[model samples]
Target: MPRIKDLRAYLDALAELGDVRTVDRLVDPHLEVGAIIRRSYETCAPAPLFTNIKGTAPGYRLLGAPGALSSAPGKPLARIALSLGLSADSTAREIIDALAAARTREQIQPVLVDTAPCKQNILLGDEATLDRFPTPLLHEGDGGAYVNTWGTIVARTPDGSFTNWSIARIMMIDGKHMTGLVLHPQHIAQVWQQWADLGEPMPFALVQGGEPALPFISGMPLPNGVEEGGYLGALLGEPLELVQCETVDLQVPASAEIVIEGHLSVERSGVEGPMGEFSGYQPHETSMQPVYTIEAITHRDDPIWPTVVEGEPVDEFHTATGLTLAAEALTQLRAAGLPITTAWEPFEGASHVLVVSVAADWRTALPGVSTGELTQRVNDVIVALRFENLVPRIFVLDDDVDASNVGELMWALATRVHPTGRRIVRTGVILPLLACYTPEQRHTATGDKVTYDALLPAAGKGREPRSSFRFLFPAEVQQQVLENWPN
Candidate 1:
């Protein structure tokens, strides 16, 4: 992996690895650029750099599918690996292992610099025009071109000790202002509510492009009051250089391509949503979301706007956020002393599905444990106890199978999980995106969850040893087979 010091360095590295494609064709932000990027993500193609975008300045380029997976052989997880400072040859297990290791290592503080390339051009007040940049309208039915796709929002609590970094979509309402949807359940929205309750607008700074690690950290499932900057610094083995926003007190990455300084109005809200979400489905209704007043815009000479083409599985958002969430879940479960061996985010279904593989010893210890009992226990431990929302299904597998491999998991489910005996279902509100249950089943306070025990029983009464070939093979034969096979 190339050493990524800033956003520009990361872009250069992508280009060098043949993972970035620069297109000179003029594409419309209304949908053309977004459509192309979405297709690229589905095909696992290179990132599309739209240099000539309709209704935008010449130099302003939009980077689509920035962190989408790569098609290159031996580099399936390349996009995430690059973002996390890993080699393109890194595997999914390696990526998760590295992150888990970094979490335990010493924290690296950010190096503060007086001036950065992002400040090369500063637009404030009337001069700061969001329309000048090429913001892509991701979906055909989207309300407008969203400028906040894959962008990081930095906001500090009133007391200043707790800082939050998160990703939220922002639509350009006008030249100097925009409207952002802050879901009631999200931390950012909750913080906005707190400020609104106190009759104060929440100060915020939206960063377009910075170190890829910044966005990765923003999407992390860390505990409350944990600073994303500190997490990012620790992951990168260096401190992130930050600069104060022109209008807001919040500090942003000094090397960010574009920074929008603004505040969320407590007393005001406008119709927000109808934008395609990570679930690959559009919301049926638009709600009154918080309004953002953009006070300033700062950028480098030629900024590259990173974006995610949100739709279905295999999109940039799914691959990026899914891997991050899986790694986080594993780390959290281990930290909590859970007897989990592996965790995975299956790409076929929505991001809400998490498959956890555990040691057979742990599964056998809880004998006669019904599916409902196991589901309730696991759900309580993962969601109710950890407070990590959005997970609806937890499929537990034996240690022999890899949770990341859907095929192996499906095989286990087919042979081991009996519908009448092992299938578990707990109905309640868990994930809003789950199409299986109706709205009535969703519970805001404590949602319902299910766990499927896809493991074979060790022993059965009045039954022969269920085919030893299915469970184990001779160690000498396995070694011989592996040795005889050609690379």
Candidate 2:
């Protein structure tokens, strides 16, 4: 396994693995190039590199669908594995297991360097120009070009002890200005709001493409005040090197491909929306978001622009966010002393739904209980609902069911759950993204939800033994049957 320290190194690794394919033919960045990449993501094809983007320098390039999919066999988790310091052959179970293990390790702090390759060339004050870069106008109806896609925005709390790295879309507003959507509940937005309340501009740095683990950690829903850089260091098994920004009082990865130093005005607001999101739908309203004044721009000689074309499930954004959320959920549940067996955010759900399989011992622990009791207990264990703006719909299952496999989970729900007897609906705490729920009902307040108890009936009450002889088949016979089946 190769350890990549920066975007250029990682791109080299991807090319070596035959995961990246370059198209030398001239392509337009306006809409043509984005459409091609969108089609590639839809088909789970190789990462496409547009080397000859219209109106851009020859060396300037765009890496579309970088974390989209893997062409390897029996390795659907390849992209995530690479991002998390695992081999390409790693399985989904292995990826989850690795993350769980890392969570238990000691934290490693990142090292700061005085100079780095990211500062090979710097544009300051009036020289900084956002239009010089090949920021893609991704969707047809998008309001403006988005400059930061797979980038990480670094911000610190008022006390400066808590540093946060997160992924949020940024749109180019002018030659030296941009607007970013910092959702109210997200850490970035929270930090900005604190500065806004104090009547101070929030200094920030946007780093585009560094170590894969860096961006991966940025999107993770870790506990508030957890240092993302330290988490990345732990994941990489080496301390990441950082350098101070030219204008902002912030530090960014020394090996980052491009660094944009800016400040968010506390009193300013600008139009932000109308771009197609990961849900494959655009919201009807265009709202005012925070405005950022770019102070400087720095990058290597030739930088590779990495972006996620957000729309529909199974896209790059969905996969990256899903893996991080699932891992974070598992960590949170275990920390709360819950015996969570498995957890998965189905790509089709787009982070709106979470499926959890818990240990069967819960049924015995709470005896003489009706199906509703199990549903309430299961709901109590879920931690995402407690998050202000991320209340996801959850489906609880027995240890035997695989949360990642929708078909298996559905089969269990159909055979074991009685429609009227096992379903429990609590319509009080839902996320706004769920189209099924009305906008007014999906606010941050507690909303309603439903839990379908699909666990097998307890050992008594006229029901057959949950663990029967037929259910425990010989392992060798099962293996033989699978081996004999034709593809």
Which window of ten consecutive residues has the lowest lDDT sum in model 1?
461-470
Q: What's the TM for model 1? A: 0.90
- Tell me how candidate 1 scores on lDDT: 0.74
Off by over 4 Å in 1: 1-3, 360-377, 385-387, 420-431, 439-447, 459-487
lDDT by residue (tens digit), candidate 2, 1-487:
7666776666676776777788899887787877888888877777888888888766777888767667555666666678778887886656766776677677788899889988888999888776667777888888888887789998887778778889888888887888978875678988988888888889989988777777777877767767788877777788889999999888898988888988898865889867877777766656688888999999888777787788887786667777677777677777766667767777777767767677777656556765566566656655343342454466667777766666766666667767676655654544455555666664444566665666666557544543433366576866776688634
Provide the lDDT at 355 for model 2. Answer: 70
- TM-score of each prediction: 0.90, 0.91
lDDT (CA) for every model shown? 0.74, 0.74
Task: Assess the local accuracy of residue 297 in candidate 1 as a C-alpha lDDT between 0 and 100.
Answer: 89
Top of the candidates by lDDT: 2
lDDT of 1 by residue, 6-39 (tens): 7778777777678888899778777788889889
Taking all chains together, the TM-score of candidate 2 against the true structure is 0.91
Report how far residue 486 has shifted in candidate 2, in Å.
6.3
